[model samples]
Target: MTNRSEAGWNFDNSYAWLPKTFYSSLNPTPVSKPKLIIFNEKLAESLGLNGRNLQSEEGTEIFAGNRLPDGAVPLAQAYAGHQFGHFAMLGDGRAILLGEQITPDGKRVDIQLKGSGRTPYSRGGDGRAALGPMLREYIISESMQALGIPTTRSLAVVTTGEDIIRETLLPGAVLTRTASSHLRVATFQYAANWGTDEDVRTLADYTINRHYPDIEENENRYLSLLEEVIKRQASLIAKWQLVGFIHGVMNTDNMAISGETIDYGPCAFMDTYDPATVFSSIDRQGRYAYGNQPYIGGWNLARFAETLLPLLHEDEKKAIGIAEDALAGYNEQFQSYWLAGMRAKLGLLNEEKEDETLIADLFKMMHAYQADYTNTFRALTFEDYEDTALFGSKEFTQWHEQWQARRGKQEKSNELSHQVMQSSNPAVIPRNHRVEEALKAAVEEGDFSVMEKLLQVLAKPFAHTPDQEEYCELPEPSKTPYRTFCGT
Candidate 1:
C-alpha cells in the first residue's frame, strides 16, 4: 500500500466553501472490501496525478470510499429537480463529492464517488450503486468524450464486494467521476425552494466565476450566464442529433450547467434512423426521444432561466420579460447549430438555402428506408457510393443524385469534401447491442476483455479499422426496439 500523503491530491474545494445549507458535509461510508477494476491513466495524468500511486491498493481504497485522501472534504450536494415534467425535491442519494482538485493547468475539477453510500439525501433507500450500471457509465461517458462531445468523465471503477437490491440482488460498485462541477439546474431549484433569494444570487455568482468566468465582468452577469448556458445546450443537442445519440433522461438534475453531458443512465446511440426512436424503458411517453431532445433541451433551459429570474431584475414583470426574450432565442439558436452541423455532416462547405431542405429530405428518406444512421452518413464518404444497397430505395437514389449535385457546388475538391464528411460522421459509435454485450460479459462472466476492446474501438470513432468493421453493423432484427433502464 502506498502512503496516503504520496497520492498527491491537490484539493481546492470552492463548493465546500459555499453556505453549509447548499450541501451536507459527510465522508463516504467505507465498504467491507475494495478492489480496483480500472483506472483512467490519461485522465489521471491530466489531473497531474501519478498513475502508479493511483493504481496501488491504497489508491483503490480511496476511490472506493474506504479511505479519504489528504485534504479531501467529502460531501453530498443538495438539489431538487423536475422528473418527467413534475417538480420534486431531490439530492445526492448515493453519490459523494470528494472535493475539487486543481489541475496543473489551473482548472478546478470535481472528483466524486458515485454509488459510494447513503447520504442525508438517501431518503430511506440503500444509497449504493450496482456494478453493471457503474461500468455502463464508464463505457458510455468515455465514448461520448471520444466522440468530441463535452461530458463528465469516469476516473475509475471499484467493486465494493457487497450486494445491492434493485430488480434483483446485484454486485455493488463505486465509480470515481470527474467533472468541472456537478452543479445542475436543480441546484438552483433547490436554492429557490429551501433558501432565500440571496442564496440563489450567491450560487449564480459562484457558478459564473467557475464556469463562465469571462462573463463575470458584465453588469448583468446572471443574465449573461443564462445566455451562455443556452448557447452551450443548443450546440450540445445539435451534436447529439448528428451522432444519433439519445439521452434517455433529460431531467433538470441531469442537465449540467457546465454544458457537459452529465448523466449516462439509459442513454444509447441509435441503431437505425428513426426520429421517434426511444431507448429508455422509463421514457414510455417518448418525451426524450430522438426527435424530442431539442424540445426537451429548450424546456430544461426554460426551467433554468426561471430560477435566474430573481437575479435577472428587481421587478418580477421585467425579469419575466428578460427571461422570455432569452428563452425565445433557443429555437433559432438550436436551428442554426443543427443546420450548420447537418451541412457539415453532408460535406456541404458552402451553405445554400436549399441545404436545409436537402438535409430534411435525406432524413425523410432514411426514415422511409429504415437505414442505419451512422453508417448511412459514413457511406456517403465513399466516392463510388458502394453501399447504395443499404438505402434500398429509389427515393434514396434520387436523393443521392441531389446530394451529388449539392456536392458539386462545394468550393473544396471531392477529396477535401470526403475528408470533411468523414470527420463529421463517425464510422463507429458505442452501439446499443455492442454495449449490452460488453456489460453482460463484465457483470455476468467477469470478463473485462470485451469492454476493453469496445473502448479501444470507440476511442477512435472516426477511423474505420478493418478488424473493427463488425462494430459498424446494425443490430439484428431481434434487437430492434431495444429498451434501456435508468439502473438506479
Candidate 2:
C-alpha cells in the first residue's frame, strides 16, 4: 500500500487538542472491500491534494476507512441538540473526523468520513450507510455549492464491498465530506450541559478564533459571536428561500454555526410556488415548511444564545438581558436580508417603499395560478410576445402590465434589468423527480450516466443551455405530492 503521508495531507487538527470529553478518539472501522466511486477533482486541487493519487487504489482504501493517512487523528465529536424543540444529548454516531488539513492557501478545513462505522454514540443502531443516501448527499451538496450558497462540500464517495440493512438490504458506501469546521450550536449545548463554565468559555473562544476572528478583540466577544452567527444564518436562510429550498429538518443539531447548509437528508427544492410546501415525511406538522425556514433559523439562533448566556456576563440578570436583545434583532435582520433578495429576484435595482407590495403581488399571482417558481422568474427575461403564452390569464396580464410600469421607473435600461433578473433566478434546479430517477439508475441498475448528466447540468444552474432545456421542465402530475425520507 502507498503511504498516505506521501499523498500530501498536511493534517493539523486543533479541535483534537480540546478537552477529552469534547470528542472520543477512535479510528474508522475497516470495511470488507474498498472501491472508489467518485472523486472531486476541482475540490482536491483546491486543497492542494494530488488528483491522480486520490483516484488510485491507495486512495480508495484510505477514503473507505481501511487505512489511515499519516498524521491523521480520527475522532467522533460530542454534541447535544434540540431535535424539533426537544433537547437531547447526541454525538457523531456514524461519522469520524479524520483531521483538519491545512490547504496551500492557509485555510484549515475538516475532512470527515461519513458512514465509516459505529462509534460510541451509535445508540444501538448499525452505523453503516446505504449507497443511495451517500449518493444523494453527493449530488445535493455539490449542487448547493454551485448555486453560490455556502455549504459543506462532498469530496469523494467509496463503495464498501458489503450490504447494509435499511428498509431492505442495500449496498454500503462512505462519503468524504469537507468543511471549514464541523462545530455546530449543539457543540456548545453539549459543553454547557456536561462541562463547567470554563469549558463553555473555552469553546466560545475557540469558535470566535475559528469563525469570527474579527470579534476576538472585543470586550463582549461572546455576544458579538452570537450576533455574527445570527447574521450569517439570516443571510443563509434568505438564499434558501430565494431558491425555493426546503431543508426538511431544521433541527438545532443540523444548523451549522458557520451559516453553511450542512445535512441534506430529505431536503428538496419546490417545483411550484407554495409557501407552506413540505417534502420531508417526518415533518408531519409542517414546522419546517418552505415559508417557516426564517422563523426556524431564528429559533435555532436563540438556542445558541442560551448556551452563551454564562459567558455574556457574570451577572445572571445582565447576561439574560444581553441575550434577549440579541435575539430580538433576529426578525429585523432576517427581514432586511429577505427583502433585499426578493428585490433582486424581481429585477428591482433600486428599492422603493412600494417594492414589498409589488413583490407580494407577484407571489400572490403565482400562488393563484400554481406557477412554477423557477420558470416564472426565468420567463420574465424573454420578450412579452414570446413569454405571454406561458401565463395566459387576465390577472396575469394585469400583473405583467404593472410589472412593466414598475420596471419603467428604474434608472437602468430594460436590458440591464433583465440581466440582473436572469443572474438572480436559476434556469434549472435539482427537481425531485429528476434526482430520484438518477438515484434509481445508480442504485438498482448500476448506471451512473444519468447521475453524471444531472450533475453537469446542475453545475451551471443560472445558464439556459439548449441541450438541457428538458431538465428545466416541471414534474408531471403523477409525480405530484412527492415525499422525501431521511434515509436513515
Candidate 3:
C-alpha cells in the first residue's frame, strides 16, 4: 500500500468539511480482476500527472477501484435535483469523487470514478456503467475539450472483468473523470431545501471565490454570482447549438455550476436539421429537445437562482426581487450568444443591425427544407463550388447576396474568412446512427473497428480527407428513424 504522502494528495478537502447531510463518507466498491482498456495520456499530461506513473501496475489498480490511491479521499456528494421538471433527492449514485488534485499549472481538478459501485445515492439500482456508455463518454468528453468547450475530461477507462445485467448481460466498466469541481446547480438546491440558509450562503461564497472571484467584493455578491453563471450557461449552450450537439439529458443535476458540460448519457450530435430532435429514450416528452434546450437551461438556472435568494438579501421580498432580476438576464445573454454563433456559421462579420434577420432566414430555410445540418456547413468547404454557388436554392441565393454585400466591408480577405468558418463548422460529429452502429458491433459482434474509425475521424472533425469521405455521409433514407437508449 502506498503512503498518503507518496501519491501527492496532501491537502485537506473543503467539501468534506460540510455537514454530514451534504455527502456520504464512502470508499469505492472494489472490482474483481480489473483490466484497463484505455487511459488518456494527453489529459494526464495537461494535469501535470506523471503519465508513466498512471500507466504503471499500482496506479491502474488504484484507478480501477481495486485499491485506494495514496492520499485519496473518496466521498459521494449529496444533492437534490429537479429531474424532468420534478424535484427529487439525488447524488453521486454510481460515482465517487476521489479528491481535488492541484496541477502544476495551479489548476484544481477533481478526480472522480464513475461506475465505481453503489453508494448512499445508488437508490435501489446497480451502480455499474456498461462498457459502451463508458467509452462513449471517453470519446465525447475528449472531443468537446478539443473543440474548446469547458467539459469534464475522461482520464482512464478500465474493464471490471465482470458483467452487469442491463436489458441483457453487458460488460461493466469504470471511468476516471476529471473536472474543475463536481459541484452542480443541484448542490445549492440541496442545501436550500434542507433549510441550511447559512450553508447556502457559504456555498455561494465558496463558488464565487473559486470561479468568479472578481464578483465576490460586489455589493450584491450572490445576485452577481447568479448572473455570472447564467451568462456562462447561456454562452455554453449556444456553442452546443452552433455545433449541432444534443445533450439529450439536461436535468438540473447534470448541469454543472462551473458552466462545463458534464454527464454524457445518451448524448448525440444531430445529423439533420430538426429543432425538435431528441435521442434519449427517457426523454419521451421532448422537454429537453434540441430547440427547447435554451429554454430548459433558463428554467434550470431559475431553480438555482431561487436557492440563492436567502443569501441575496436579508429581506425575503428584497431577495426575491434581486433573484428575479438576475433570472431576467438569461434570455438576453442567450440571444446575444446565439446570434453571435449564427453569424460565425454563416461566415458573417461586423454584425449589422439586420444580421439577426439574415441568420434567422438561413435557419428557417434549413428547417423548412430539412437539410442535413452537418453536411450543409461541411459542404461549404468543397472547393469545387464557387462561393456564390453555395446558395443552390433561389431562396438561399437571395440571402447569400445580402451576406456578400455585408462581407465586402471586412478588411480581411474572403479566403481568410472562409478558412475561419471551416474550422468553426465541423466536418464530422458523432452522428447518432453511426454511434449506435459502432455500439452494436462492439456489443454483439465483439468488433471495435467502427468505434476506432469514428474516434479517429472525430479527432480532426474539421479536416477534409478524401479517403474518409464515408464518415461524412448521412444515414440512408430507407433506414430513416434511429431511436437512442438511456442504457440505465
Candidate 4:
C-alpha cells in the first residue's frame, strides 16, 4: 500500500471553511457488508474516473462508506431553513462530504455520500435512507440529467446490508451524489441566524467567487450575485415547466446556492394538465404545486435576500432599498423566461406581442377542459391539416388557428416551426402513475424490469420509439394517482 500522504485520492479536497458552530465535523459511520447496487458509468467517466475501477472492489469499498478513500475529508454540512413555512435548522443529517473531484474537463464537482449514517445534526432521528427511495432517486435524477436540466447527478448507489425500521422494516441504502457544490441558501441563513455578519459576508463572497465570478467585477458584488441567482432560479424553473417536472419541495434550504436543482424527494413529472397539481403528500396545502413553483421560488429567494441584508448596505433603510430592488427583478425575469418556454412548447418563432394572449388563451382552454399537458404537445409533433384525429379538442384546433395566424406573419414555414416545436416538446416523460407502478412492483416484488424500461424510454425523451406508444398515452381517469410522499 502507498503511504497515506503519497497516495493519490482519485479525488481532491475543498472544505466549506464554515465556522465550527455551522457544522459538525463527523465522518460517515462505516457500513458492514456494503455492496454496490448501481454505478453511473457515464458520470464517472465525465469526472475523469475509471469506469472499470468504479465497478471494482476499491470503488465499491469507497462508495459504500465501507472505507474512506485517500484525501477524503468526510464532514456533515450544516444549514438552517424554513420547512413548510416554519423555520428549522437542518444540515447534512444523513450525508457526509467525501471531498471534491476535479474532472479531466477541469470542472470541480463535490463527491458526497448521502444516507451514510447519523451525525451531530441528526436531531433525535435515525439518519438512514430506505432502498426504495435510494433507487427512485437514482432513476429520477439520472433521467433529469438526460433531459438536459441543470441538476445534481447520482454517481453510485449501494445497499447497506442492514435493515432500518420505518413504518415497517425496510432495507437500508446509501447514495453518492455529485454536483458543483452542496452549498444552499440555507447555508448562509445558518450563519446569519447563529453567527456574526462576518460569516455571512465570507460565505457571500466565496459563493460569488465560485459560482458568480463575473459579478466580482461589479461595484455592488453582493447585489449582483443576488440578481444573478434570481435570474438562474427563474430560468431553472421555467425549464422545469417546459419539461413537465415538479420539484415537489421548494423549501429555502433545499434551494442550492449553486443554482442547480437538488433533493429529488417526492418529485415527479406532469402526466396531465392542471395548474394546481401536487404529488407530494406532505404538501397537502399545495404550496409547491406545479403552477405555484414560480411563486414558491420567489418566496425562497426572499428568504435568501433577508439573510444578505447586513451585507446589502450600511444603513438599514439603504439595505432594504437594495434588496427590494434586487428582489423585484425576480418577477420580470420569471415572466420573460416563462414566456420563452411556453413559446417553445407551442412551437412559436416570431416575437409578436399577441403571442402571450394566444398562449394564455390556450392555457385557459387547457385548464377548462382538463387536458393532458404532455399529450397535447406530443400531438403537435404530427401536425397535418388532414390529420385532426391526433388533437383531442376543437379548442386545440381553435388554438392552432390562432397560432397559425400569428405564424403567417413570420418568415418561417409551418413545417420548420413544427419541427422546432417537436424537438422542444418531449414525446415521453416519467409519468407519475407509471413511476409509482414501477416502484410498487419493485417494493412488493423483487422485479425492477418496469423501472428499467421506464428509464430506457425517458433516456431519450424526445424520440419516438416503436411499440412504446403506450408509454406516451395519458393515465386513465380512475388510474390517476395523486399525493406522492417524501420517503423520509
Model 3, span 51-153: residue lDDT tens: 6777777677877887776667789999999989899999999999887777777777889999999999899978898888988888888778767678999
Q: Which candidate is the best by lDDT?
A: 1
lDDT of 2 by residue, 354-410 (tens): 888888888888887788888888787554334323467887778778877888888
Root-mean-square deviation per candidate? 1.4, 1.5, 2.4, 2.5
Model 4's lDDT to the true fold? 0.81
Tens digit of lDDT per residue, candidate 1, span 198-239? 999999999999999999999899999999999999999988
Candidate 3 residue pairs in clash (backbone atoms < 3 Å)? none
TM-scores of the candidates in the order shown:
0.98, 0.97, 0.94, 0.94
Please give the RMSD of candidate 1 to the true structure.
1.4
Worst 10 residues of 3 by lDDT: 381-390
The 10 consecutive residues of candidate 4 with the worst lDDT sum are: 1-10
Q: Can you write out model 4's per-residue Cα lDDT over 213-286, one digit (the tens) per residue?
A: 88888988988888888998998888888777899989887898887899998899876678888889888898
In Å, residue 222's CA in model 3 sits off its true spot by: 1.0
Q: Give, for candidate 1, the lowest lDDT window spanning 10 residues.
A: 383-392
| Residue 281 displacement in candidate 4 (angstroms) | 0.9
- 442: Cα error in model 4, Å: 3.3
TM-score winner, 1 or 4: 1
Clashing pairs in 1: none
Instruction: Give all candidates' CA lDDT scores.
Output: 0.90, 0.88, 0.81, 0.81
